[model samples]
Target: MMIGPTNLSLTLEQLTGTDAGSVDEAPTNMVRDLIGAWKTPLDQLTGREIGLLISQQDGYPYVLDLVWPMLEDDPLLEAEFYPGDILSSLMRADDTTWRDRPNYKRRLKALYERALRRPDDETEALRESLEP
Candidate 1:
């Protein structure tokens, strides 16, 4: 079922044998690569777990959290896999399932807040648009 962000992080760490310090210490590109490589986990997981993973991975307060944003944003980045499509794919099943999770929404709000705090030229516009 749908794991909360806390549970999802715990589970993924358990499954992958990765720790917070290690995940944090790894080079940004390496983390991006790991996220990029885990596309299979995103698809194979249940909807809830998938949502959890998405929330946990992209919901962080650091730019490091945004990484590639989705598998399609990797070398395979293509117009065919529009941003929404890539986000949908990461959430598994659909955006409906992702939005239904209160935990995901909470994390998303936190992420939005984080994003607003240290925006660059590119994200400044996104931040303004995202804020109320």
Candidate 2:
């Protein structure tokens, strides 16, 4: 499932369907590929699809770079009905996942601060998790 750098963009873009209904439950291997790919058209994906992606993640830099921003803008992503607990997945990040990335905590703290700017309960919850 680990696609080469050359195919990464085209795969993610193609996987990020232009039109959407329910999230695609088949072709789930794309989720594994996304774990290493630097960019994904997350904007075109649903809360459910993104949740699947996040669920499979290991707290890589992509969490800070790609996932959190999408959650910030989309109120729907905060809903509890997605395939996984996005908030918990984010909170569960440990040193093993980001040990070499010393900046992760600082960036996460900043994200928490930004989350406070939003009035929604989920974002507030997200803000709380980002710190711990």
Candidate 3:
């Protein structure tokens, strides 16, 4: 299902065990509010939660644009898992319609490059994550 900000807020509340409210705020606003309420490092969230955020059907693009960047430097966000999952998901979503979304391609390319630069041990996992 398409998960917009309100849905995302609910999901975050469920996952993080905090009440971030169900207001239909913009994705960025909801992210900000959730972060504030979470009070913990974003990377403290498990890989599964990060995967859910990246794989959301509706606001995935916005989540990538806004939230992903924030989590990029989080030590808890494993490079092999998080970036690989995001890159794989982005590539899977890139269809004929993706051509019109230059920003998406740029972000996808950037993530791919970042994944490639991971350490040898992590790179293996990244490669495996991308494989069909």
Candidate 4:
């Protein structure tokens, strides 16, 4: 049976180690290119823009580690982000139907929800030991 094109790309990317490790040199270069392409004047950008840039370049998730502490008492933002959320979503992708999962705008939203629901008992039980 023939797999679909989406599966084909996913298979190729997995074989090439794209999903298994840190963003390789090529993806790093591509992110850099996207940043340059999206050169909105600094004055025009918002927190989301900053978060996205840091996320792409660092391969970090939800921009939480990068932006959380600096956000003051903004529960709105904190409630919106969590460490490992984005990364987990990327890692959980089904090899065949990633694109059809949802539109890009809500991808992070779904990821955050899923991450929040993961077993947190072990995490909550060991705060100091878990600090990284």
Candidate 5:
């Protein structure tokens, strides 16, 4: 079957064993486990898949922490993933205002800035100096 955002969300819910509607109420350990389970190989994902994953309101923190780092390693994938599109999707995902989510704008801005940073082929030792 073709995978879309809802399909991806359902997969995540199944893998993590946390209902999407109740993700916020899930325990810290469960959330941590979900983070680990959500860490799919960046190379295996399509741009649209990546977009859908990050667009998920319930999955935002996991996507930010786990997925953004992977994007840094691949110039093509990083360039193809648009922060604006994700931001728009996030806004539309819920009726709540952006200001209500304390870290949403900060995290989004950070991701946008990271996207603008130069993509490099470097060792872990040299990676720190390359970050914006």
Candidate 6:
């Protein structure tokens, strides 16, 4: 599917290598280009783009990793979702989607734990949301 207002044809499957059996350069480059495009002051990604990036399909883990570093950057200020809301949503994506890639799945979990421990503006509400 198309991402936000961009003319690029980024689909959920391409967001992660998913069934590619090995890492190819195109998807990574596509993601990189998307991020690069979004980072421009006039071209920030919308909440829907973020949602699509961290979507429940193949987009979750791999795209999550790619975008994780952007969370603390200026891009966060331009997005529609709160930092807490985005982090919590990323943490809650269906973990089972990548059951075959145990290590990758673990990495996503680690990101959540790291977020919780980092004491950022996001994790406080995320921690409260996950409370039992």
lDDT for 61 (candidate 6): 40
**Model 3: residues >4 Å from true position, as ranges?**
1-47, 71-83, 96-101
* Model 3 C-alpha lDDT per residue in residues 37-81, reported as the tens digit of each score: 344234354455455555543233334434455445531245235
Model 1 over residues 1-132: C-alpha lDDT tens digits?
453233323233354455434434557854643454343333244433333444444433211132234321231222232222223333333345344254454444444444435427524444333345
| lDDT against the true structure, each candidate | 0.37, 0.46, 0.49, 0.36, 0.43, 0.47
lDDT of 6 by residue, 12-130 (tens): 33443233332334367646544443332222445556654554243434444445556544222223445455555555657564454455455666556656665566455567756
TM-score of each: 0.28, 0.42, 0.46, 0.23, 0.33, 0.43
Residue ranges of candidate 5 with Cα displaced over 4 Å? 1-11, 19-45, 74-111, 114-132
Error of 6 at 92 (Å): 2.2
Ranking by lDDT: 3, 6, 2, 5, 1, 4
As a whole number from 0 to 100, the lDDT of residue 48 in candidate 6 is 55
Instruction: Give per-residue CA lDDT, model 4, range 2-52, as digits (tens).
Output: 222232112222323344333334367656433432443333334555445
Top candidate by lDDT: 3
TM-score-sorted candidate list, best first: 3, 6, 2, 5, 1, 4
What's the lDDT for residue 128 in model 2? 45
Alpha-carbon RMSD of each model: 13.0, 8.5, 9.8, 15.1, 13.8, 11.3
Model 1: runs farther than 4 Å from truth?
Answer: 1-95, 128-132
Q: What is the lDDT of residue 14 in candidate 3?
A: 51
